[model samples]
Target: MDGITGETDSLGVHLHYDLGNGDRLQLLRLATVAPDQPLAALVPLDGDGLDRLEAIDRLLRTLLGRKIPQDTRLTPQQRRRSRHMLQAIDGRMNGASYRDIATALFGADRVNDHPWKTSPLRDITMDLVKDAFAMIAGGYRTLLRRRHRGS
Candidate 1:
């Protein structure tokens, strides 16, 4: 596999190919197959079968030097929120308090417009930090799937 990496796991040897742009494509090498050999996917019609199929399709396109498709599960708002969450976490890790993080994120002018105890930015900053910590504590896997409206 050109520039691909492999890691052994219970599922099998997982071959990971970095797609750049913070995205990665992984293929489970379940059976013996050479990199030069023609590859095929045998996805069963299970709960996550559709996701697996989409990944396989993306892998095929990647191998063919085609553009990989973006995941439609995340909306622009979600992407923005995720980025903000990382920023909040980074600020906190750098010894910044919630108010300081809010100041940096929302600007000092807006943060100064209201009292610290009642500013909405304070609450938003808190939530972002909490969400980021949750992601670090194994909740990041949920990013792979979209959340249902009622759930």
Candidate 2:
């Protein structure tokens, strides 16, 4: 499994790899500009999976309101491992620097220095991953509840 890192405006979100199926573990944000935002959420599909990656690409482009550079395809591996989004947000919010917060949350040795490009597209992609999982999880949980009640 790949040790993955992604960030949204310096909020310090990360995605680790899962050994079993190579799925991205989830994005975890240690802090945020607003108190209401969640700390973490899972992406439903593997970060390297074709459908999910394409979806993410489209999502980022739309959110940024600009076309991805013609040569840029935005492969999942790229998004799965990026930490720029989190750092950028931190920069905007005047919060603790990314290095400090990331070190605190993920340990000093583990934090990498790769930069992530932040835009509306990146934000949307992060959100979509969470939403996709919630919708599915909610359906299954509801079904389980109904089944237990019926029994």
The most accurate candidate by TM-score is 1
lDDT of 2 by residue, 1-151 (tens): 2354565545555544342456554555565534356343235654334445554565455434667544234445544433433444344346655454445445555554333244334344445444444544553333211112131
Q: Which ten-residue region of model 2 has the weakest summed lDDT?
A: 142-151
Which regions of candidate 2 fall more than 4 Å away from where they truly are?
A: 1-72, 81-83, 104-106, 109-151
The best candidate in terms of lDDT: 1
Backbone clashes, each candidate: 0, 20
Per-residue error at 128 for model 2, in Å? 22
For model 1, residues 30-123, the per-residue Cα lDDT tens digits are 6466546665789889766666777778778877788988877678998899999999999999999999999888899999999999989999
> Model 1 — TM-score against the truth?
0.73
Can you give the TM-score per candidate against the true fold? 0.73, 0.20
